[model samples]
Target chain A: MDHSSKRGDRPGVSRRDFLRGTGAAATAVASLVKVPGVEAQEAKSGADVVAIGPGPVKLSLEVNGTTMTTNVEPRVTLLDALRNYLDVTGCKKVCDRGTCGACTVMVDGKPIYSCTMLALEAEGKKIRTAESLIDGGKLDPVPAAFVACDAQQCGFCTPGFVVAMRAVLDANPKATPAEVEKGLAGNICRCGTYEQMRHAIEDLCKAGGK
Target chain B: MDNFVYYRPKTAEAAVGLLDAKWGTAELLAGGTDLVSLQKQYIARPKKVISLSQVQGLDQIEQSRGWPMTFKIGAGVKLATLAASSALRGSAAALAQAAEEIAGPQIRNMATLGGSLCQRNRCWYFRDEQSPCLLKGGDKCFALDGENRYHAIFTQGRKCVIASPSTVATPLMVLGAIAQVLSPKGKREIPLAEFFKAPTGPEDREHVLAPDEMLLSVSFSIASDKVKSASYEVRQKLSSDWPLVQASVAFELDGGTAKNVRIALGHVAPVPMLSAEAAKAIEGKPINEETAAAAGEAATSGAKPLSQNGYKVRLLAVAVKRALLTAAGAKKYWEV
Candidate 1:
């Protein structure tokens, strides 16, 4: 007799639900399980929550000391997520097969190929991309030295070199020529700017990586 | 690359459980340095991926003090970390050198010991995804007759012409390393020799790991006080390239003579090739250029080279000689 009044008294019940009927309401609740590629545990919370997805899933990442949230498909690499979704395009994508160091980024203080790493795998780590090198409108010592020494000609590979060089110098402050050679061996410049790259790194080493 | 579901399990048991649940449709993801490339090439297209990145505490390098000192290298430890580990560098120098010589710094930064060992063959035909090589369940092996340069010289009587691609496997074999594998059913340990299996047929993988199993860690006894070891790889480019041939020598020295020795060659066979003949040649002999040359000659005694890769036989010999000389602290040949 007063079904609408009783439904209203029940908190969180929608006014539109009365017109749609309870069958539609039940269907809406049941649709949550229809999410494709998601495991049953995705509905649960805590460590038990296993988000297996080809579909989009929300992720919280600590990037360059900033907490950023983004939704990404499980198949999306960290490099793609950073460049496409988060607008962190400083990391270049080249030889996306993990061969070229063009997509190098620091995950948990260690340089890793971002193109080969899934964004979901880097969920709890501190990710530092090449974009993090700039401070107060000034370039980091390594990138500044790259410019001063003309380490880049085509300039497409500059960002990866800069990020990798930062890791090298941070790991070894007074790196020798051999050490620097081994350290920078990961990144390549097809323009044959390696001599200049080494010179720029030597300059940074001399400047104490300020 | 084909889209797929990804699972990041925090524990080894959970990871194994996921693999068990997914069964034939899942692939374990570690490092992704090689797996991503395989995926990009469509060589590996698993419907579900189980990422081991969340499995913590599997990255430690511990050296236990025993009668024969043992070193346990976690499967999750990066190749770069292993290469730079002072503990490993001091005790297991060959392993460190092999780790350092793998690919380049960026690849090593993302590669792990288990991933390197479990990596599929680098045969171009097999990796093409369209070549329909015998290793991929095709009727014929393209590498057997087409561009057979990088194909194995000693294929261990298998139809597949692919050679083992693991640089670490060579040194680990010489060191007598054991792999601790964990499965949903239980755990098991396999020696490096048994861990890598030569492809017997079209459907055979490079290793014998089951779909539900994962390599947990690798353990090796430290080289004794009487032994000296070294790893030598003859890569095309010093920058970042696969080796044409790699050799690792572990020599037990008595005064200046080799009491006993173990030598293993890589890229010359389907598995890391241990040359018992080479080891026998130099046993009870003085560590000199002559003995080293004899051992080198012995290493290539039975090599059946493919048309384009006959040069690999000479390279393998030279690698063995140089590796032995280096391990014995003798003057290295081929310096010029």
Candidate 2:
């Protein structure tokens, strides 16, 4: 809904000039083909908020097997909604920058970072988190293995890894140590629990007996 | 973090038209991996945010007779999807490998090749609001004498010390591809090799596209002859984080001897750079350990790492060697 990422208006220096002249000689020949897909935008600028049709709307998100509804700003990130509004605090907020996988969640059977995802972007989609690891006070195997294998030290990054490992294990129960490592590469354990995490996933495969 | 208006355009023109109306103040959001980081670091605070996610036909990755023997990947295509794709996983495996190695699955899910290529510098000075690096038009580049490890040695000049962050473009450079852009004015298709810019300028620009333009898609036409390609990346670890160094090697075999060797180095220069001289050094050689080792040496022969990043120079060599083996149909890493 916002195009702020396209502007090179950083502080001090004007990156617009830097980004333009850097790639010269190649962009000389150009053509424009107008194919309509996006909503017809009002041809105006400098407005702080542009409401194309309807104003702000209330919505519901079924997170961690619970239907939670709230009024969300267009700019609200899923992480912000989960942390500040809904209080589903299992997803850690470390490295609020998208580089860290501390806020990973599953939407429609695929894993994606909630931090980078806009709150409204994932509307009506299935959302899962580390909070879903326990069923009726029973620990899920992947998470149970994480605790048994001591795959966590601080417990902050553990939830992110558990969600990611669940996705990997769902697809490949016998995923090798390398596969496990690659699968969880997005999830970072600051306490250096990599070896234990690998063992945890390996133990899950062993228990599956496949 | 500046207060801004955000708009979502569902098509290439809608995205371009939004850029046209808010030309100077608008920013494009594809994956937000680079832009969000830049915003957090206060490097870019665009007044307007336009989304390319809902744009149809721009996210398609398929082969059709309308285009040549090619892969048409939409600009909004996610890196994770590209990595997991079986067709891409095999034929254009190097690009897939590079895509998979970026940040992590979540980042790959959000990050796109088009966004990664057009992203701003990951340099600390450029990103941090505190520093006034030359790329920001300040006098001193901190990487000149400061913590210069990840900065470029090959394309470094007096202005900037940042390295290009796209792992996808390195393999694209080897694949003989072109990037298509649509703006309010018109559309233009530029060769992938010429789309990037050097940082050795007072203006400090990176790509050839105008400020009001949005990337439509990147078109890949196969090479003139049969060329096997692979890409190798060296990172601190496997994750969504950027790579420390990357190399893409495409080898054309003339039955026995190598011909038309194309070697491009990423994170070692200001742009997704091709070392033609380095590639020429082993143009007619075989893909044996000896030849690949030699090509690796040539890839770094004239490389000048920043004072602290000497390890990257050798790191790139290993990547080149492994990529050469992969390009030569080395069937070991694909077992899984």
Candidate 3:
């Protein structure tokens, strides 16, 4: 599939550099580049698509503002791919199941649990994680609001909350208290910082997301 | 997680053609909110994971406004979109309410209608890889004798104790929805009532979906002015938690008198159950406090709760009563 045409490309980010950033073994990346031709035929042709594989295959992801290519097993989740392959670890991984919103990210402007999503399915989609909010050492308005209101306690779930808050505010800048509560219901803070988070959200809604 | 070949098919036919009769040969990946978790827990280890993300036209919601106004909801439509849809709120209010109350925002943003209905029971024994339950080809179900708190109250001890966990299923059943299923053989439509089946044996599954078939869309009509429909769910927490009891009601009223009624309950049985007795009790009766309460009492007629889940009987009755009152447009019912 032509994934690059949909999104413009960046020059400096190489596939090997991204794989190295993800901390994958050099041999594993080597084997992944070689297995694509055989798997591509099985997947595209009328032959059975349920082909078995214990090897890595070439995959590309459009993350943040760049298209990064890598090799990974089909079983690797989006959460694992972002953290391990692309070194975009801002989205925390807690309660690998969909219950906790700690791994929340935006896919085509919609917030979804990255832990439950497969990396292969996100090949050509526009993905925005918490890492994208930090542009040139400046925090995005949502994270700034979070810091201003002291909305985090242990800081483990802060990125997910920030992403969720960004999504909610972007969709409804003047969101009511009820809407904020409903929109952020997926995320939980073990440190009991919900009251502070609400305060931050209310502040943002008042400021029109600054 | 077990390694599997991932195929992203651009066409619906290609997606279904990947399916084989074997249990773990290939599994459809829709939304991945439930399927990924099942794979993580080792409950579902398919050799091939066929992703339907690239398949076109399965993510749109089409509405028709003629006689028998209906909404043809694509099975792949996100739950959050369905919940927040203003079109659905006007006619299919119960479905919107059910969608709004399922899980949390992140999960709702990713979970699809087909995925929610096809998700297996959340029985701890069934979810735990260590326990060899009856559904997993074991001799006995551990939920029958251990940790029976969340087990079924209506269909207890049949073969599995896990209740149907689909929050949307209850409302769909009350709306008399029809599921359009596409098989390798052909396309067929089945009513929601006949879509789910109780497990008759060890090899049986919950829904009638074959291994090679895929759910295309779920269509339901909401036309009559006399019909008022609503859904009520009572959960242990206000956050994203599985509902303890859920009830959906659609009442056909003629000048405050219930001409006909449909009441369905979830999380209390192996399937989303239509309470015929409750509906019969309120038929032709004025929808008042006394009649509503009586209908609620009659709804628990054939409940056979397990040792620890007897408390669900009262919870189910209360949910039914509240749901019926909500559907009847009774003022100040939530206050009581």
Best lDDT goes to which candidate?
3
Interface RMSD of candidate 1? 2.8
TM-score of 2: 0.83
What residue runs in model 2 are displaced by over 4 Å at the alpha carbon? A1-59, B20-24, B65-68, B156-158, B200-205, B223-225, B238-241, B330-336
Docking class of 2: incorrect
Instruction: Give one digit per residue, the lDDT tens place, for model 2 in B106-133.
Output: 7776778789778776788777788877
Which is the leading candidate under DockQ?
Answer: 3
Q: What local lDDT score does residue B312 receive in model 2, on the 0 to 100 scale?
A: 88
- Chain A accuracy as TM-score for every candidate: 0.77, 0.72, 0.78
For candidate 2, the C-alpha RMSD (Å) to the true structure equals: 11.7
TM-score result, candidate 1: 0.89
Models sorted by lDDT, best on top? 3, 1, 2
Q: Taking the candidates one at a time, how many backbone clashes does each contain?
A: 0, 31, 0
- In model 1, which regions exceed 4 Å deviation? A1-49, B20-24, B200-202, B333-336
Worst 10 residues of 2 chain B by lDDT: B17-26
* Candidate 3: regions farther than 4 A off: A1-23, A26-54, B200-202
User: What DockQ does each prediction reach against the true complex?
Assistant: 0.34, 0.19, 0.35
